[model samples]
Target: MRMKIAAAAAMALTAMPLSASADGEVNIYSYRQAYLLEPLLNAFEKETGIETNVVFAKQGLAERLEREGRNSPADVVMTVDISRVNELVERDLVAGVKTDTLTGNIPENLHHPEGKWYALTTRGRLIYVSKERVEEGEITTYEQLADDKWNDRICTRSGKHPYNIALISSMIAHHGEAETEEWLRGLKDNLARKPQGGDRDQIKAIAEGVCDVAIGNSYYYGNMLMDENQRPAAEKVNLIFPNADGRGTHVNISSISLTKSAPNRDEAIALMEFLTSPEAQRIYAEANTEYPANPGVKPTGLVAEWGEIHPDDLSLQEIANHREAAVKLVDRVDYDG
Candidate 1:
């Protein structure tokens, strides 16, 4: 319980600077909330005798790392979403790390080929339909979101959101830019309202009878179901794994990278390897209701209750490559409007 957690802003102003190479200590800059990481980090510390320090932020951790450069005390950076992790690589803030343990624990497609970053857990971009309105078999694929029959019945968060962007990127990977663009436009035309709020809001919209369908991540539904206030709304919708019979559902990940300037390199790598272990993977996955990236670890609790996920085999690298195109398609279609 010797963990130190600081808000990014507070750390900048008041905290004493850390040594570049502190013994038995690993520093982290994370976009993932501290609570979600607490159990995993605490476990790492107790077992390995390495103290953990974390600076948590919703935004700007990457830029902060860039600013601090080689002198930065950060060892490992943890964050969710493909675009964010790819941004770290694009900015040249992380170093390549390859190990037998890492390779054995993580799927090839879930980690960078060059070993710059590795995914810890995954969550699918799921379709949510009103239990009362949409038929179970009526909308089974993402392609059908554009169908005329569902016009004025669909709801979603902003298309430019990373989750939607990744989904669109996957679409571009599978169908090419032109076809993806057309699908985006058709989806835009089906919106029940201007894109607004988080994924949970889309589920709420369905509950309130504002729309019959929505797009959201699997964990959001699980989270909502766990909350008494939101469970009623969550219960109104059924989770649909789109394209389960074909290309499979598109999934995004929560990932970790070793900073280029990691002073605690050995401990950092140990932390990474430990995270992929069955014990840690189970803790990480269950904490957020996400699928474990370690293939040996199966999702439990509510996530397991949802059944198996056949994730789209399209490489995440390809999804990252198509992200710019997906953003362009979103803007081109005025999807937020």
Candidate 2:
């Protein structure tokens, strides 16, 4: 069923090969980091002789799409979070794509329900704790962070961070606002230092004994443990996947879609199909130190080394389904307030 969908999508949008120099030119508007996305783009260009041009930004890709509109030269819209995908959809800036390859590749949870966006890779939102301070097997759940026991021993990135927002949203998905609020209030009281810096900084603070535990997406840990500045933080911290009892770990995706008015619609579809194939998926995962959306693909070595985790099966639609409510709850709780 999945494979058939991808093939149909591939054929559906492709037109005359637009006789370019086969430079494999693909114009991508991405929110994913340039360093993480570049390796994959380079590899694709090398294999297909296509030139990959990227415009990387933290926000406002939608505005760019809107500005360009029907005359937009963009061939692909690639970025993170379900909210971003939904934004593209709401703007009518994305087109539906079907490819048996994509279907067989990405899980239904990671991809758009209506075939508009396909999750290319995923990151787990989990806990990071100080090895020297946090005893092994002491904390096992996200709710534990809200426990009074760890008060003043926890460090976190800013609540305003999207990752944190999505995490709070996930809690709403499972436990509702009132219950989540109680947890939030507890966590707020427990703040080690007012949620300063990025995920890496939280782990670093733990190493510095500023906190005993922290919450972060998995890749920061992967990067910290690998390429980032090393210290006790890199050495003394461990990662834990929480919420796996029934809801599974909170997982977020970096996905791709085609512009609704893409001038190079065929090129966009081709790029999308090529992306879901095994080769691109591998690069996508390895580069980002994330899990590939395809079930058949093993996580990159770093991820495999992180050990296996049961991810939340809730679809992008389901996770995204609660966005408005999640936003309201985040504001109501005054997470950053």
Candidate 3:
């Protein structure tokens, strides 16, 4: 049944290609939700007189692309997490891209060295502490989460989740596998409850007194504040950008890649270049409430209020290389058990 549903969805996406319209269009396979990307695409269309057609899915685009092979209609692939981007590259589904616009606007660390993929925005893995139970300057670094004092007081999603995996991968980059394994075990032992739910649920647990501290993405805090029921819980916790004193906070990105068999190569490159432009970056940043990947564009709205984010200097590619080790360490500690 699942396979049938996925096949039907893929067929629906591929049946309509960019050439269906007189105006040049770029077909996109996106993991990002429609509501978040529609506005940005609309801006792109208005600016360049190009049409944007998107097939939004939660998963399976990579497999679908590989199955479709050379005949695939997908011109661009956009997704969150370095693992997903690397997955596309490893599958040989995306091609290398290089342009003065892309290379100049984006930092080298945030894009693929071979130009196969580029990041559009970033979000940090932040600590959310109950204002009443935790004090200022009490918790300043991720290493402190392993301390015995936080035992029975910390909350998070499953350790196997990609967001956590990327964070753990960064830990492996900064500290060796053995030390990272020890830290993973210590953090697991400190859990307030069996790991469950999304990042927002962790913050909600903090407000309910089920736990005093939770780990979640920085954008989730802003998202919660925009929601009425969630705003109450969001208001109760203060965000702590861990490792601010040392390497800076552990961060992840939302990124884009060009399909290996892109039929509309020129149009796809145009959309990719537009996405990295300051105008489009500003619109995307404000609409999605994420920190723009472009250094020239400052974060606005609720994100700006969170204060300056000094992102960790580690290269995303380096962190991605350690993902396998990180996943093994999670299981070694039985982190989700």
Instruction: Identify the candidate with maximal lDDT.
Output: 1
Top TM-score model: 1
Task: Write candidate 2's Cα lDDT for 24-125 as tens digits.
Answer: 366677776566776676666666665665566677778867876776666688888777877888788988887787787887777887788998888999
lDDT of 3 by residue, 1-337 (tens): 0001112244456554434233487888888876688778888888887877777777889987898888887789999888888889888899999999999989998999988999999999999999999999989999899999999999999998889999999999999999998898889889999999999999999999999998999989899999988899999999999988789999899999999989889999999999999998998888877899999999999999989999997889889989888889988899988
Ranking by lDDT: 1, 3, 2
After superposing candidate 3, which stretches have Cα over 4 Å from the reference?
1-23
| TM-scores for candidates 1 onward, in order | 0.97, 0.88, 0.94
Clashing pairs in 1: none
Residue pairs of candidate 3 with colliding backbone atoms: none
lDDT of 1 at 216: 95
Residue 117 of model 1 has an lDDT of 92
As for TM-score, the candidate ahead, 1 or 3, is 1
Q: Give the winner by lDDT: 1 or 3.
A: 1
Error of 3 at 195 (Å): 0.8
Q: Relative to the unseen true structure, what is the C-alpha lDDT of residue 98 in candidate 1, on a scale of 0 to 100?
A: 98
Model 3's alpha-carbon lDDT is 0.87
A best-first ranking of the candidates according to their TM-score comes to 1, 3, 2
- The per-residue C-alpha lDDT of model 2 at residue 115 equals 88
Query: Could you tell which candidate, 1 or 2, scores higher by lDDT?
Result: 1
